[model samples]
Target chain A: MATNITYHPSPVTPTVRSSLRRQQGLTIWLTGLSASGKSTIAVALEQALLRKPYNLSAYRLDGDNIRFGLNKDLGFSPKDREENIRRIAEVAKLFADSCTIAITSFISPYRADRDLARQLHHAERPGGEPGVPFVEIWIDVPVEVAEKRDPKGLYKKAREGKIPEFTGISAPYEEPLKPEIHIRSDQTSVEDSVKIIVGYLEEKGYLSAPPEVNEV
Target chain B: MATNITYHPSPVTPTVRSSLRRQQGLTIWLTGLSASGKSTIAVALEQALLRKPYNLSAYRLDGDNIRFGLNKDLGFSPKDREENIRRIAEVAKLFADSCTIAITSFISPYRADRDLARQLHHAERPGGEPGVPFVEIWIDVPVEVAEKRDPKGLYKKAREGKIPEFTGISAPYEEPLKPEIHIRSDQTSVEDSVKIIVGYLEEKGYLSAPPEVNEV
Candidate 1:
């Protein structure tokens, strides 16, 4: 009986590489409305982390790159939304395990789904593999402000019925009850936002003093 | 009918936080078998990238985290395998959108499943986000060697029927038809494997030249 099955080996031993990087690995999940400055703040935060001795990899899953590929077949349904966030959370965990800064931004409006992500992050690795830490950051942008500043005219389209199940307008955006950090984009400038983020990271020990960069 | 939805303003201005971070964004995908050294390599790669001037994030999804969560109900059935990879790929795209290195590890044996990941990487935002580069690297180790080094003892249990579906041994292991790189643990050493991978990154322009670091 020729069963159509295939197998592959698993990998172990990232400890040495992680030590070389000199930073603990974790996932920074940014959740908020479309124009709540989630992506903007995430981007700024990445730059702030760069000047330090840490290695940070930031991934933002906005409308631009996701609509076509992994989610091409997914429509704007509540179920799809959960699935979408669920998938992203899983990937974020993977990044965390590799000892890199895995950052993600999504509406992720449901408490259960966001909690689900947290749960996955804390899980132990199979066969004694270490677990990756999951950090949930809520980019707290008021719905009204987000609608007013729809960067891509998404709010307008949602109201006009051009896009069904739009988040914040047609759809729902659940405010995170509790998060590692809450960034109110409306109140702060992008630079200040970066400063605040960097400040937190510094306190968290993710940052080190400015290095003498003359040596390459 | 108040349907608990979050709304935001439209026509938001593009901020520097978003623009600046875009320049430093990239994806680092780590693909390999179970215990063949994919996660180990991914962690090392993340550490290496962290020392550079770019913002890099690493994501590693293997047996422990994923199997216990979103994929908890699912088994190692073929359909489940496809679904598992599909979900992870979708999440990776989201991370990529955020402009971070999204490194994932799985025994994505079949080419079809791997191709699905590539397709997911190519999915774009509404206007079509630039295709997220899909780098597939096969971390190669002979099945027997992998079983011998079964860090999780999965292969052992699988052969004994304790596990219904497993990769290698009782299951099939389809060699990647077109892997971007092949890291053979059997013949090559770990340092050599890392060298090969880092070399690929340098070749791809992901890694910059070394810099001298002076600690205070």
Candidate 2:
């Protein structure tokens, strides 16, 4: 066995974790219709945050990871969709609690589902400790523009009646009344969209670490 | 928005993530009967990894986080138990892919459930990349000894028929045939258990960062 190691009795709380990692944990929830450039912007944002002059640990959760991995058992039924979002929100909260920037790119168009996600992140912890920050970024785009773009031809399939109950097509997308950040994807470039998010995080002091603690 | 920020176009793959975070992500899955000291060892291991000499990012997933948060919808039925383990494995894989050590503490009594978790981690990725490592640490302790300790009065409850399908009592506990690390918690102290794990990680070179890359 190993020797010369002292076992610290205290638990690793969020404050202690932030000090050790040199960064705060938060989730940047990106909601939009399909083809709204959410995934594109999310990719660029993750890259920018991982590189200097920030060098913060960041990860993006999207259809690729969630739909295929965690929620593969879930389908398009209303109940399944709600469960899908719930699992995503919980996973993102776990990531945030671990002191990593969690960026979730999803067509989480339902307002209540999105709200539940925000509430989970903002819930009070034991000892009245504040919860991890949740930043909602509405990747706004006119349905016409998103349909016209049709990068994945999902809108075409939806219109052809092949994919029923798709968001912004046969189903409803209740827009966010008070999202933390709003980006008109049809008007802004991907780089600019990322910059807007990075700017918001910086302005809100979520990008930097707090003063050092002697104890790790 | 923000100025002087350059957007790098490359997607943050596992290789890129490891280079940026200065650590490789892996899951340490601890399995045994209840009161086997898995949670205690997990907390100590997480603390040890986050401190100096290791300084790695690590998180623990146990009943406190898993049962109450992500898998709250689940129950104690056979199917629900399987789903519970599945979700935990998937989330642990995500954490590992993000370049953080994920320590999962559970009684995971069945061999098949634990094997499925290991396979998920060892499954090949796209582009011929190696999958994240899964280290199974079996916290070995005799059921009688665990029943004697009965930290939560769970054994008494189990014997009194208060709880059904309790591992090592009503249900079966399948021991691992080829676990990467095996700790006899009955014969070992918590500090020593943590040391044994740390020593194994150090011997395998899992504690250090790889050579720096030019690109982030």
Model 1: per-residue Cα lDDT over A1-216, one tens digit each = 112223322333344335544445677888888788877776666655543344343334444434444455556688877777776676667656555566776778889999998887887664455676666777887788888887777788888998887877777777888787777888889898777776777687755422333322
TM-score of chain A, cand. 1: 0.82
Q: In lDDT terms, which candidate is top? A: 2
Give the Cα error of residue A76 in candidate 2, in Å.
1.1
Q: How far off is each candidate at the interface, as Cα RMSD in Å?
A: 8.6, 12.4
Displacement of residue B31 (Cα, Å) in model 1 is 8.5
Supply DockQ values for each candidate.
Answer: 0.17, 0.26
| Best model number under DockQ | 2
Give TM-score, chain B, model 2: 0.93
Q: How high is the TM-score of chain A in each model?
A: 0.82, 0.94
lDDT of predicted model 1: 0.63
Write down the TM-score of model 1's second chain: 0.79
